[model samples]
Target: MKMVSYLVRHHLKMELRSLHNVMSLVIFALASTYTALQVLGGKPDPTTWNALAWIILMFTAFNSASRVLPEDLTAVRAYMHWTVPPRVMIIARTLHQSIIMIILSCLLLFALGLFLGSGNMDTLSIFGFLAGMILTAVGLASTLTLLSALSARAGAGYGLTAVLGLPLIIPIVMISTSFGTDLVTGVALGQTVQNLYYLGGLSIAIGIYGYILFPYLWRS
Candidate 1:
């Protein structure tokens, strides 16, 4: 518990020092939202709105979460191996990134609402949208953290991160987007619940995989 707290604090401190990363993500969110508004031309249809919002959030999450593993893999590996258990390290980092992605998700949603105009949504739909974003963020953080480890091992840059991460992320985006679309369109209650269940199941599977597999990657 102490080790986990320490690593989480370390991540927080590092993020504080590097405020530029957060700023960049905000800027990207704004620019992307603005460009989307222009291209999509003033209050897009529900499908377009849902798709665009998810796309922006997806890329933003990718940019921020991909940095879970630093460029200098050897140094990070040595420090972590000497200092903490692999499970502790992975859990801390995943928790940290999950928080960051959730924030980004909120920001993206706010930007979308501002630029795209919240599009005929009611209270329940809004709640559903928020729920979807939270689940998506958790899923992204878990999957990307492990894939970031793999990308680090490959010694490639964000290119490899995208290559390896996108395959995993697409299914998430698909499911989440479908759920969001349903929410926007006022789908049946039973269908919405089913979508939520699928997302929950995927998140649990990814979390279990990361917890089990990250130790081997840490050793490598």
Candidate 2:
């Protein structure tokens, strides 16, 4: 627990030192939303709005996750390999990425609502969409963290993370989009509980795989 916390805090400290990178992500999300508004020439329909929002969020996840492993150089990785358990390292990275994704998701949601307008979303619907976003964030983070490690170990470019991660996250995106669309179109939360469960289950499954697989990847 202490090691995990220290690793998480180390991530936070590094992020704080790289404020411009964080700003770049925020700018990317806001700019994407604004571009959608300009291209559509006004507020889009609920379905269009939901789709655009998810696309931006998905790309943001990819962009942020692309650097997850490369930030640690060969020496840093060697040090960590000796000092930290592989499972602990993966857990920390996933948790850190999850925090980052959650914050970015919220900002993207606010940008979407501001530029494109969230159509017909009531309190329950809003809550459901928020829950879906959170779960999707976790799913993406957990899945991508391990992919980033693999890409690094293979000496592949960050783009490899996208190549490998996109196919895996298709189900996640589908579920989140469906749930978001339903919420945007005024479906009640109770009707969408199944989607939430599916998202949570998928995230847990991916996280477990990453936890189990990272040690082998980390060693080689």
Candidate 3:
């Protein structure tokens, strides 16, 4: 456990230090935010705007996943292999990507708040909105991290990551879109509680099991 935490910390530091990946994520997020605002126009119906936010978030997440795998050009990834257990490295990268994703989500939500109106913006509902975003971010990050580590593209890492990340994020898109719309429309918790539970459960299951298997996947 300690080792995993250590590796994750180091991975996050390296990720933060990497100008290329950080800038790419920011650019993609800005583009997505701009597109989402255009889709919203002035004041879109709450439901339509809510769905647009999820769609934009999903695409941005996909674009960020492209560069997740450590660049093989440097010996850094090679040294990590010798020092840290593969699982630790995998979890570390996953955490790094997850943080980037959550940041993007917050940016998108903030942009939406500025340009689009949320008909229902209460404390409990805002909590629910954030809850949905967390689940989506973690689930997508872990799944994409595992897929990229396993399926090494000789050169086309970006294209391959997209193919692998898309299918995994689809279910998340459904749950997030539904919950976001429900929150915007002032729907009762009872009405949308099932979607929330499903997302939370899936996120936990995937984060745990995905790491356990990724060590083997990374090996072969």
- Best-to-worst order by TM-score is 2, 1, 3
Assess the local accuracy of residue 157 in candidate 3 as a C-alpha lDDT between 0 and 100. 54
Tell me the alpha-carbon RMSD of every candidate: 1.7, 1.2, 2.5
Task: For candidate 3, give the lDDT of residue 3.
Answer: 84
lDDT of each: 0.82, 0.87, 0.73
| Model 2: CA > 4 A from native | 68-71
Clashing residue pairs in candidate 1 are none
Better of 1 and 2 by lDDT: 2
**Model 1 C-alpha lDDT versus the unseen true structure:** 0.82
Q: Model 3 residue 154 lDDT? A: 43
Q: Pick the candidate with the highest TM-score.
A: 2
Alpha-carbon shift of residue 87 in model 1 (angstroms): 0.5
How well is each residue in 14-123 modelled by candidate 2, as lDDT tens digits? 88998787788889999999999999999999889888878998999998887645336888887887889988999999999999899999888888888888766876
Q: Measured by TM-score, how close is model 3 to the native structure?
A: 0.86
How good is model 2 by TM-score? 0.96
Tens-place lDDT digits, model 3, residues 85-152: 77777777788778888888887777767667554567777767877887788788778777666556
lDDT of 1 by residue, 88-202 (tens): 9888988888888888888888898999977567767776787788889889888988887777777686688888888878888889988888877878545687887788889
Arrange candidates by lDDT, descending: 2, 1, 3
